[model samples]
Target: MGREFIEIFEEWAKDYDESVAGQDPQYAAVFANYEGILNEVTARSTGTVLEFGVGTGNLSEKLLQAGLDVIGIEPSQAMLDIAKEKHPELTVLEGDFLTYPVSDTPVNTIVSTYAFHHLTDDEKAIAVKQFKEILKENGKIVFGDTMFASEIEKQAMIDSAKEKGFSALAEDLQREYYPIIDTLEDIFTTNGFDIEFKQMNHFVWIITAIKNKE
Candidate 1:
């Protein structure tokens, strides 16, 4: 589903931690309060979680530390390898937002951070539809990712990035499917979820969507 970005992750696997730590100025604002964002996602998650895009297992480690059972899914082998190396006991699989294996145990929550933008808007809707089928009633989806309030805001961000000489950031904003809040609201509610959005930083927002119906 998100394999289009596999090569980027392959190259970024080793340096992901540093990039998120604000070492990469081009992405510092994008990853601002990086650990805090992960912690917020972890705090919102519940039992038997399925984590999409578990890059380097940072959020996975936090989930485990909080005593939650987590199954991580990543499409990039290089990224998954790093995650495995970091947490030898972490349960992980090769998958993406639109494809993955599920255990017999019912998944109570699904959590992801900074990764959902890989999917286009249509794909995002499809993923949410599939998630509703897999989760138990009232199960939650907690995601911390970059999102904009509107098309105007999205364009403004791109312009700002360009003005700051952040061509890479601007290009990333254009290339990836960083969605608008209204579209996300439509997708979740149309898929039978009760959703809420909370701002985490200038570039990221925490989306909490609960499966409210069968």
Candidate 2:
């Protein structure tokens, strides 16, 4: 799933920012919500932020404005180049999120916006453990992205779209396996992190999880 988007992003990285928000009202709203949640969660912190999938520096720029030292990880060189150009001060690393190695310095907050969903559920679980390793004690992971809550909801959403003659959309939805909210909680909990999940406008999901603070 993650790999699929990487190829597309390489070509789209140049105009990604404007297109992400400029397409339509709904898209603009979604982009706004993503920035808002990332800001809201990290507002109180003053530390290094390790942002995964730092595409075009959209959220990384936001984090910088919030007063955090930013280290961005991106797989696409083209996308990373844009990010570096936008903020040369930013330490943007070009590598896969699953395999990218964090510097020896521990991170205070880890963030990924609208990007983490590219991972399959199992890959996410592995990433969670890797995140725990690089974070300082009591560190947090704040994620805001596309997600669902269950198979029932997933199927129901697909059915509704199909019934409305949205067959093409339904087919795309069927092929994409988004992370479920309840399942995400269990994954985080099982991994020794405490989590909070919220659905915004019933389409976007915001997740905040703190590493094993105990």
Candidate 3:
């Protein structure tokens, strides 16, 4: 589970909006075109959506505005608190990608943004497997997060971050478990999904995976 990063998120809850707004110069490139990325994810989602890592309800707000039924799950209580305060009408529960309550309604789409990197590759595989089980026939998963084309590309980005003197950004890259596109494709295909990826920015990619009917 990604609960191990709850404390970090709790601390980040206050300045997260600023960071995503490109106010933090060090991370501006990382969050480039944040609004467009959120809108792209919202555009791909449909029906009842189970959104993991609904940090501060930014994407959730978009889903609601689109008139889709949204169920948000977050691990950090502090983050969840702010999200609830921002959108009182949204139902956000305290949970991570791998540990969340079973939804009462059939899930039509699963979504997340900039948060899935919290899970390691193995954990991501498990989460995808779980998604397959819970999703309705032909359901989908749309996630926008930091991912790389290959391991070499991932290390190159980290090295570049350090060279640019972005210590925090470099450390964040070294710390998190950002997956490679190939690994994600393998995971989704092995679990019966047709997956596609679209680069949203320098760091983020919008991954849309739809379950294949059995």
Q: Identify the leading candidate in terms of lDDT.
A: 1
Per-residue CA lDDT of candidate 3, range 132-174, in tens? 9989999999999999999999999999989999999999899
Q: Give the local distance difference test score of model 3.
A: 0.92
Q: Provide the TM-score for each candidate, comma-separated.
A: 0.97, 0.85, 0.98
Error in Å for residue 7 of model 3: 1.5
**Tens-digit per-residue lDDT, 47-151, candidate 1:** 899999998999999999999988999999999999999999999998999989886666999999989999999999999999888788799999999999999
True-vs-predicted CA distance for residue 19, candidate 3, Å: 0.7
lDDT of 2 at 109: 85
**Which 10-residue window in model 2 sums to the lowest lDDT?**
22-31
- lDDT of candidate 2 over 7-57, digit per residue (tens): 767877876777566463424434555555656656734498888888888
- Better model by lDDT: candidate 2 vs candidate 3: 3
Clashes of 1: 0
State the C-alpha lDDT per candidate: 0.93, 0.76, 0.92
- Ten residues in a row with the worst lDDT in model 1? 99-108
Model 1 steric clash pairs: none
TM-score of 3: 0.98
